[model samples]
Target: MRSAPFLGLSVAATLSGCAVPEARLRAGLIDAGLPQPIAACMADRMVDRLSLAQLMRIADLPKATASESVPQFLRRVRALGDLEILGVATSSAAACA
Candidate 1:
């Protein structure tokens, strides 16, 4: 997948607060076939504010099943409350954009 490289070193860097550039992260997510709005939302996050597990989940979003739309997947994720703990304001779909 296009995000393979991002999954390895970049995610680690992100968790450490020395994240890869936001543009690169967003492009990687886009290249992985994630919807632009979802990618934008995830890319805008402050990596330092998220836990390693949270970062990993975000990176893995591209692997979501074809049966799921981005909004549906995001809604499920939001329901988990992980994003809330990370301070990601996910009260509306617009927040994701």
Candidate 2:
């Protein structure tokens, strides 16, 4: 229906204002215990691939006090129970490493 298409456009417009910056995403990743280089690589890839809502969601995940290993980070993400987020993070970690 015409209403469905219009609703989609409206939602897109609203989310456009919520776009997460690459630098912020990278910083968040680093805060989450990833190394700087890996965080930067993953942030670039994820910002391109994930939606705004997903990005915002991940931003609120637990941050580590110290740098964490890849396996440790993945395990923490997996614990949160969002498969798509986990998948993107895992693949990005693999690709960036």
Candidate 3:
């Protein structure tokens, strides 16, 4: 006896946390020592729903293990390789923007 709409809403809420808001993502980057402007760049790209790998690359995140959580992924992105451009992803993700 679960309603379909309720299930849908539940899914959306769960996914929203995984997706996160652009502002929060930016703040995380700055707190992690990444430049603040990159947040805007990443948010601009996010206008399109990017793949998980694409987001990781744009944010300069590392590959995660089975034990990793969504926040863990964000943390890795914040590390950001100490570079503004993150060195073009070195074959990770696609060239497509």
- Largest lDDT belongs to which candidate? 2
| Tens-place lDDT digits, model 2, residues 1-97 | 7699999999998777445466677877888999999988988888877777677666666789888998898898788788998899899999998
Give the per-residue lDDT of model 3 (tens digit) for 17-70. Answer: 665555454454445444445444545455245444554454444323344333
Q: Which candidate do you rate higher for lDDT, 1 or 3?
A: 1
Better of 2 and 3 by TM-score: 2
Alpha-carbon shift of residue 36 in model 1 (angstroms): 3.1
**Model 3 spans > 4 angstroms off:** 1-5, 21-38, 41-44, 47-49, 61-97
Q: How many clashes does each candidate structure show, in the order listed?
A: 0, 0, 0
Model 1: weakest 10-residue lDDT segment is 85-94
> Model 1: how far is 37 from its true place, Å?
5.3
Instruction: Give lDDT: candidate 2, residue 4.
Output: 100
C-alpha lDDT of residue 27 in model 1 = 64
Residue pairs with colliding backbones in model 1 are none
Candidate 1 residues lying further than 4 Å off, grouped into runs, are: 1-17, 21-33, 46-48, 65-68, 78-93
Best candidate, TM-score-wise?
A: 2
TM per model? 0.43, 0.74, 0.33
Q: Please tell me which model should have the higher TM-score, number 1 or number 2.
A: 2
How far out, in Å, is residue 9 in model 3? 3.8
